[model samples]
Target: MENFTPSISVSSQVTHSLLARLLALAYVDQEVDLREVELIYGIALERGVSKETLESIMLRPHSVSTILPSTPHERVSHLYDLARLILADGIIKEEERAMLRRSVLLYEFTEENADGIVDFLLEQAQAGVAPAQVIQVVQESI
Candidate 1:
C-alpha cells in the first residue's frame, strides 16, 4: 500500500467518490447503463482509482470492508455529497442506500457514529440541502 501511487488528480478523487456513490444508488433499482460505466471509468482514470478498484466498487452489491479514515471531515463530506447526488433525482434507490451503507463501512466510521452519519445524510438528501451547506455541516461536526 505504501508503494501504491495513484496517477489521478485530487479533484478527480472527489469526483470519483461522488460518481461511485451515485452509481451504487443507480444500481439499487435497476441495471447500470453503459454510459454510467463509461462515466465511472473516465472519472476513475482521472482519480487514480484503478480500473480494478472501480470494478470492485461498482460490483459491490452490499457492504464493503472498513474504510480507514483519511480525515473525519473529508469522509463525512463525501458521504453528504453522495447522499445529495443520490436524491437529486427525487427518489432514493435501493442501490444507493446499500452503497451508502457500504460506504459507511468503507469510511471506517465508528459503529455508534454511523447512525448519526446516516441520519445526517438522509436529512440532507430529503431536504435538498446545498452541497455547500452539507460541507459546512460536515466541517462543523468534524
Candidate 2:
C-alpha cells in the first residue's frame, strides 16, 4: 500500500483539505508517489472533515482553489511553495516541471521570483531542513 499519511498539521479547513487532496492527486504515479484515494481518507480523518465533503471537492474537474486566492500575493505565495516542493528533490520529472511552470505562470510570479524560490528550496532541502520547517515555510509563504 502507498504511504498515504495525511499531513497532521492540516486541520478541518476546507480549503486546506482541498489543496492537500489536489496535490496528493498530482503526486499519483510519480517516482515519489502519493496515494490519492488514501490521502483523501487520511486528510478527512486528520482534519475531521467529512468524507462526503472531500468527495464533493474531488469531483471538480479542476482544482477549485486555483481561482479562490483572496489576493495576488497570496496566490503567488502558494505558487512559490508549490514550486519549491516540486523541485526540492533536484530531479523534477517532466510532468512535475510542467505543472510548476504553468502554476508560476498562472500565479503571475516573475521569472526572478520563481527562480529565487526554487533555489531557496533546493538549498534548504540540501541542508536537510525538517519536514516541519518545510511545512512552516508553506504555511507562512501562503
Candidate 3:
C-alpha cells in the first residue's frame, strides 16, 4: 500500500463533497425536477467531478464522503450554490429552508450569521436577484 494512489483525484473528491451535500438538500423535499438535476450536473462538471463520480453520488448522496472546503469563503460559496438550488423549481419548499438551516451549522457558520444570511438569500431569491448577484451580496454582507 506504500505507493497506492486512488483513481479519484482530490479535486474530484472536493466536487463530490459539494455535489453530495447539494444533492441532500435537493432531496429534502422528496422531489427532484429535471432543471435541478441538469443544474447540478452542469455545476459538478464545471468543478471537475467526473460524470461517473457524480452519478454514483446522485445514486446515494447520503453515503457520500464529504470533504467541505476549509476556508470560510469557500464554505460560504457552497452555501450560495445551495441557496441557488432552492430557487431551481421556482418555488422554495419549506423542506429546503429546513435543510439549508441544518447546513449552516454543518458548514461551520455561527448561528447568528447563518440565520441572517439564509434569510437574506431567500429574500433576494424572492426578489428575483440573480444567484451570482446574491452570492456577491452574501459574500460581502457576511
Best by the lDDT measure: 3
As a whole number from 0 to 100, the lDDT of residue 105 in candidate 1 is 70
TM-score-based ranking: 3, 1, 2
**Candidate 1 residue lDDT tens string, 1-142:** 4787767555555555555565665566676556545645654665466787677666763434333336676676667755755565566666677677777877788877776777779788689676567878777766
**Model 2 lDDT per residue over 101-140, tens place:** 5566555667767756555655564465654566567667
- Sort by lDDT, top down from the best: 3, 1, 2
Model 1's C-alpha root-mean-square deviation from the true structure amounts to 6.2
Residue-level lDDT of model 3, residues 1-142, one tens digit each, is: 4786666766567778889888877777888887788878877876777688788887887777878787766777677778778887888888898888888888887888777878866777667666567657656865
Instruction: List the pairs of residues colliding in candidate 1.
Output: 25-96, 28-95, 67-106
lDDT of all predictions, in order shown?
0.64, 0.53, 0.77
Error of 2 at 7 (Å): 28
Once model 2 is optimally superposed onto the true structure by TM-score, how far is the C-alpha of residue 18 displaced, in angstroms? Answer: 6.0
RMSD of each: 6.2, 9.4, 2.6
